[model samples]
Target: MADIESATAQKLLKAFMQFRKTGWHDKKISGHNPSEFKVLATIQQGANEKDYEMKLSEISQRLQVTPPTVTQIINNLEKDGLVERTVDPEDRRAVKIKLTPTGMEATAKARIRFTETFTGLIDYLGEEESEQFADLLTKVQHYFSELNR
Candidate 1:
């Protein structure tokens, strides 16, 4: 049983590594890498849920990256005219990040591509299997979260 479990874990890890190398989730989205797109998407979602602004710390938290890393990415995005940074009015020390018009357009395109990919997955996996996969993924995510705690 232990040997079988170890083999299964090794296979799973290899498959995931191959998947990452193939950039399966990053290929359809143009003009940005997967990480950059994730940051853009996070900011867009935050804006839609709350105000049209998100703090740098909020972005760091959402991305599960360090503040310095988020700042570096934000600086690059700003240089590309995809995002703008402003000082938070309520907290002058804090900075707010927002998408520029170009950023919004890019994000919209990325979202459309993402939805199309998901639709394809549903078609391939069927509705029931897809739902099960989603549930399993959520459970795995929660398990990791608990482990971190």
Candidate 2:
């Protein structure tokens, strides 16, 4: 039983690693790398949530990256006219980040691409299996979250 469990665990780990590696390879949209797309997506999500804008620190935290890294990315995005930085009205010293019109269009394209990819996965996995996979993943995520606490 221990050997069987070990084999299962190893297979699961291998599958997860491979999935992470390949997941983003073919998902690029509008010539933006995954990191840039992630930042754009995060800001867009915040806006959809009625936040309208986000702080650098908030973006860094959400992306699980350091502030400097996020700042650099945002700077590049700004240069490409994909995002804009403005002074935060509520906090005079802090700045807020928001998507430019170009960013919105790029984000929309990326979102459509993402949806198609996931829908393909659902078709392959079958609806019931997809739901099961999602539930299992959620449970595993919660387990890891608990471990960090």
Candidate 3:
């Protein structure tokens, strides 16, 4: 049983590595990488929920990245005219982030593409299998998260 479990684990690891190597996530959306798009999506969702510009710390916490890393991405996005940064009026030391018009449009288009890609995956997997796959993935994530704790 131990040998069989070890072999199964090896196969699972290999499958994960191959899936990553396939570059399914490396594809750019609206000239932005997946990480950048994630930031855009987070900010957009935050705006919709709070109706206010998000502080840098909030974004970092939501994305589970360091504040400096979020700042670096924000800098790049700012340079590309997709986002705007402003100093908080109540707290000059704090910076707020908001999407510009261009950013909103880009995010909208990218969102459509994201949906279509997932829709294709669902179609390929069939409805029942796709649901099962999602449940399995959730369980895997939960298992790993508990391991960390």
Scored by lDDT, the top model is 3
lDDT tens digits by residue: candidate 1, 41-132:
99999999999999999999988999999998888899999999999888999999999999999999988887888899999999999999
Relative to the true structure, how large is the alpha-carbon lDDT of every model? 0.91, 0.90, 0.93
**Which number leads on TM-score?**
3
* Model 1 segments more than 4 A misplaced: 5-21, 25-28, 138-149
lDDT of 3 by residue, 1-149 (tens): 45636988789888999988999889997688999999999999999998658999999999999999999999999999999999999999999999999999999999999999999999999999999999999999999999999
Instruction: Tell me the TM-score of each prediction against the true structure.
Output: 0.78, 0.77, 0.89
Identify the runs in model 2 with alpha carbons over 4 angstroms from their true place.
4-10, 17-27, 143-149
**Considering only N, C-alpha and C atoms within 3 Å, which residue pairs clash in candidate 2?**
none
Comparing 1 and 3 on TM-score, the stronger one = 3
Using alpha carbons, what is the TM-score of model 3?
0.89
